[model samples]
Target: MTLQQRQLAADTPTRFARALAVTISLGCAALASMLLAEAAARDGFSGWDGIRAVLVFVTTAWLAWGASLALIGLFGGRTTALRPDLHAPQPRTVIAVPICNEDPLTTFARIAAIDRSVARADVTADFVVLSDTRDDGLAGKEQFAFARLLRETDGAGRIFYRRRRDNSGRKAGNIEEFIRTSGGAYELAVILDADSLMEGDTVRAMIARMQSDPQLGLLQTLPKIIGARSFFGRALQFASWFHGPIFTRGLARMQGPTGPFWGHNAIIRVQAFAESCALPELSGPPPLGGHILSHDYVEAALLARAGWKVEVDETLGGSFEEGPENVLSFARRERRWCQGNLQHSRLIFAPGLAGWSRFVFLQNVTAYVVSLLWAAFLVTSAISTLYAPPPEYFPGPYQLFPVFPDTSTREITLLALGVLGLLVVPKMLILLHAILLDRARDFGRSLRMALSVLTEIILTTLLAPLMLLYHSRAVVQVLSGQDGGWPANQRNEGQLSLCDGWAAGYWIVLVGAAIIAAVQWLAPDLTIWLLPVAVPMLFAPFLIAWTSLPLNRVLFAVPEDAAPLDVVTEYDSICDVWRLTWNDEHLMPKATSPDLTHATA
Candidate 1:
């Protein structure tokens, strides 16, 4: 480490800033809870009203805490001053891409693109393709694709591929195995998902950051979503390109010295990770107990516990990852994440964890837990309206004319508006910032940006209930000891048929119908208020199917859709070549590498 880097690592975030983040986050949540309690009491109090008020407090507090982060991100200081100089010496780094049953052609093509990018920058980095594919046929295909990658990029020595027979610990195990065998050769490792693509300069910049902060264990980059074609994917792309920066910046500020590792598309110090991140399995069986499924968070916590800084650099760009193209695909991914996050419940109180690390576990826990809470709130509100007695305005010995009850509709409306503001103002602030900074052009300019935001809001709102149900189910299943086993990501897969979409979402739609019917039969007056939540449930299937289709992608077009990235364009061509030409008998040249000749032999 350089003298300057060592000096800077000595100065972490001040206690005052950490306290401020906690104060603002909790303080806002507390104030929002107080307001919700007051609003609930505006109508004469009841036990049911009290329950509603409590749920309101918990849910709104969660929202407020998020808002606080974004606000801090907007107004907080940055680490730009601590950034490493570009002309400084570089370190030896290994870029690791973990792949399972993925499309070998597309995955290796992406690696080729990344390898070329790194080669162009003249950086001393090796790329490794670690495969955990259990299927022999798919593994063979991956080997052939790796050979193609080697031939095409002329990366025989610099790029390597290895597949494991037993997919024991999944991606985490794959990485750990690499670290044990080959990690000694490099100072740092840039971990990437199969779909990850980092520009050569971004890779160099991240390495520089690591070199500048010797105590920095991991530096996560905010990767913009690329190559999205469906409406769902495009919306995500636009959000990531535009609003994602603000969110990540806020998270970075609040995280200070202890940020997060999102498993891939980030750089990590080899020595620190190897020493601190050897994950331990919790004793027991499936879902709730076993090997740590979400190993990234635990690894970060371990690093912080060992007094290493894990920070995220949101200002750095040119890193990219693909998103699921449709809602069902997204739900499938979320199902796995849901189990992983829920699994952290057991580790929340693990010994010697930093306070912030523990809080992060809670944050992951809340991400899915809030959906259940929201669902419960809806159910309780329905029950309260149906079975609970009418408001007792004359509870006391009031002598005068019996007081009349009022729902305080105006106050309720304003409260709803306040809650909406908390939920959306951060996004508005992001939009305003982009416009003011002239960054709106990156999202297709102000007019289209506004339209895209509007479309995203509508689509997300319609899809929220479905997600809530999906998440709620996943959590319940996990809690009931059902494990969501490792599933390969179906990147950019075809759309589900209407029947398939319906099959995936029938339970959700049925529950929505049941809730609406129950509400209408018990309390007709409350049905209107319930429509916002209930209507989405009924239309869940249609929403999933519609968003899954390639149609309407142009309607909410993203900047990438309008003008594609070079890597994305190249990847498409490579996919066509592999798909159409792989089966041709003589595609492989006569005198290939010995390893390739032997593997195919």
Candidate 2:
């Protein structure tokens, strides 16, 4: 029942709506660029002014685009629901959990929970643990964990484990290997990462949707963050729970059939994926050349190219994931993604790609490229200021008076407000939307939700400079041909100490101090303007460590915190009981690492 291309037209927005969104974004960008150019040209137009104008145009467009999406979600409302055939006999399905150097205990527990969850929903599905773990010691522990998991779930035959000798292709390659060998056994595969967990009913619901829509090749669920204990982590959870859906709803609306694939927490038609997504290695060396690091987005584009509907349903709930506990972990994850995205520059012109696919790649690249432009703008400004000509009093014929240049202070203020508005107005509007619709109840009622939003806004504002520095560095590293090898994610990277934060962030501190000193000495007028960004960097280690420290968990509370989902509660209980079992049997001693199940649980 492959859906025809014409059938998708009914679901897409009118050309007018899409056109209007682009119009709004570009218009905002244009005006902001104009304001910047005027301010820069007050003394005299220079190359630095031109560069600054272009940078502002690109970055403001992105910011405005983001604000536009939120507005679209707020106004356009939720997507029209596609009815599913829910009570029908479930299809042959396999929940594939991918792991690489992840904790065997916590990782396996998530699988066991998912296995038991599906069973409880009266849905029959096999669970597979695809391990690309490289450490021999970790591999030995994984086998023990698998045995324990099988025993606990009584999934001796239902659950399976396979470790690859050489994980050459990374995650995409790992999955490709699985499909190459065992994909034909199942019609649908629920792909999951080591940190991913979903409610039984959510999984069942997705399958139903796939069953109902023969044209649908993949369905992505909005996975919420859970199990956060640190301040930074909880803020991420709250924002995802609150702001993420509205933005995602807008994304889904705009995407129609050409949606996104975030690699995991998605269900795909195995046959469609196999036939369409045989990714080719680009013509080059490492970084830009080797196997594609970010394969999910490409897979979605491929599926769309093959006439399959790729969609994201933001309304569907119960999908879950974890976030980095601190800035360091986040930076590490972001660096790899940076490389993955910049690699897309090569594929932007690849043959047979859809127009939207190319645009999406452009957006991805622009997101990081904007950071470089910004850094360049600042450098150019510094250089220009250092060698600026002194104010001159010119006589038309023989006048003895010096004329001072207008600072265009008002223009500068207006431009700052416009840029600030793009960032703040969306969050404020979303807050108002929450109040109007009484959606705050979902985030622990109005007062706490409002407080959470306030804290998140402030915290994120403080972290902006840090992120800017990291993004710029990552882009530079990729350009320099540095390879950020495939490193396994440390899902439980716990509290970072001051020393640890300092170790990772000292360079930033130095940079910050240097910027402030140079600005104060060379450009006294700009010293006040740079304080907000410089202050945070000067205290980067403190900010990072403090955010990572264990918090009360009462303020930045999400829906999951207030009322744990059935699957989450069950997962915790199972882990507790299993840890006790391991301790009693002395399988993993308590004297080992702090994160070892036997020691912590």
Candidate 3:
């Protein structure tokens, strides 16, 4: 055999072995946990309460999550297969792109591209550039530039720009202003973030769904990450593109009419949103205070409460958005999301919400809490090793009390295996589905890509604990009244510095290093167990930044053949026509209609 072919053949078994090892480990851990629980029950150890609680929580959560997915699959299967016939009529729709202190040139270029693309598809979509910048100095220039650019380019009559004199509730406030002023004229509104892009078909599909089901208030599409120039950005894009669909599909199926609203790249029935979805001020501190940071979840809940459906159509393709390419930028984005999700805790138990709405709210809450719990589990496991005796059970005799015998090392090893399996096996299931179901082709060559999948999974497993640590700390800080102010994202692509990494992950590094050093000094034999935790902790920052780099992008490439372009085309054409019409009417007065001659002169 050729050397390259031999190498490829050799690597296959190694990858399979690694995957098997993870599966075996997780199975052992689960068995150990079960045995430990039974032993604790027989021995009457009071400390088992916490262990029992954890087991119950994990088991129940898994079942509930599974049931939700099954329900969604049943319902989703009933809907007619999505096709061109599903496209909604060309309604007068307002496309609102909200911006705040973003690069004007980039924003304008994207809007112009979208305008051109939508126009080509013959879509009648209006453009609204809603600015929420409070910096008075920059606002005037932005407004003037926006107006002139629209006139000079293809944005004249069809595209409009508005600046909130007082940026009150931020993004939510910006949208409210538009609805109050001119929302009545449009049947539907498509909200897009500055970095968001969609194909013409996706938008049309969304409109079609809304038209078909008047009860549907919002239709959110799964957005694929794109335009990632940096290494970090590319890695994030790859992971997001590769893993997002299954999870989204699972989530949507589970959520039904109570799915999440991610703020952008979704269509909303204007009347439903206007009548039921209003952002309310939280009468408290920084994270949960005056302005709502994360309005998407709350809006979705409100829509559900008001008897309107909020659905996430994973089957609807062609939506895309850019992710933060730098560590600092990624953190900044996370901070805002953390605060928003945290704030939802206040409304979760509010009396008026529907059961489905409550379920959705609880799901958002769980997303954050699960991170903190995983971090706690790691820390507590280490501490338990130091303070507690190994597990033991004893039978009663003619004595006052009986002590349990210590658990075998075999049992401990099995328990560890089970825990690892829980972490990695589900992903393998997803990969298997992709390969067998023909979905793997989107990633790359089915055979070669299988290896990439294994590699990505290993890297991700090593990195998961570190992310849990970062997000857990963020959640704690926000809950404790820490103010993570609105920080601008680092849009530039550059090499990450040691200081930048440290700044982002100092807590993780310090804790991990200290634990490793202590274990090495006091109990060198335990290094094997500590390696799993210590390695990830010590290199938390670098690992995070590296994984997000462009090198990882290749693994995430959605075989160019499967790329979603219908939505992209629609978005582009809509923006294009708006710009063209605006430019012709406002800039080139010599080509104006005869009726407008007096006004032009």
lDDT of 1 at 40: 57
Give each model's whole-structure lDDT: 0.77, 0.82, 0.65
> Top TM-score: which candidate number?
2
Better of 1 and 3 by TM-score: 1
Task: Summarize candidate 2's per-residue lDDT along 308-411 as a digit string, tens digits.
Answer: 88899888888998877788878888888888888888878877666677778888788887778766766666666666566666846787776776777788
Candidate 3 lDDT over residue span 1-601, tens digit each: 3332232221333234324433543444455556545533442444533554365345334433443343333223223444444444566787899887664444665676666656655677888998876666556555655765686556778899988888787788889888989999999999998777766656667777777777778989888777666655655666666666666765664455566788898999999899988787889767767677778888887877677778887777667887776666666667777877787787889766756567566666666776776555445544434544444444445555667554445544665565565556556666776787787767776765676667766776676667666678789988889977555564443456666677777788997898788777754545677788788888887875665544643554554324546545444555465446544332322222221110000
Evaluated at residue 561, the lDDT of candidate 2 is: 74
Worst 10 residues of 1 by lDDT: 592-601
Ranking by TM-score: 2, 1, 3
Model 3 misplaced stretches (Cα beyond 4 Å): 1-80, 83-89, 144-149, 383-408, 517-527, 552-554, 560-601
| lDDT of predicted model 3 | 0.65
Quote model 2's TM-score.
Answer: 0.94
TM-scores, all candidates, are 0.90, 0.94, 0.79
C-alpha root-mean-square deviation, candidate 1: 5.2
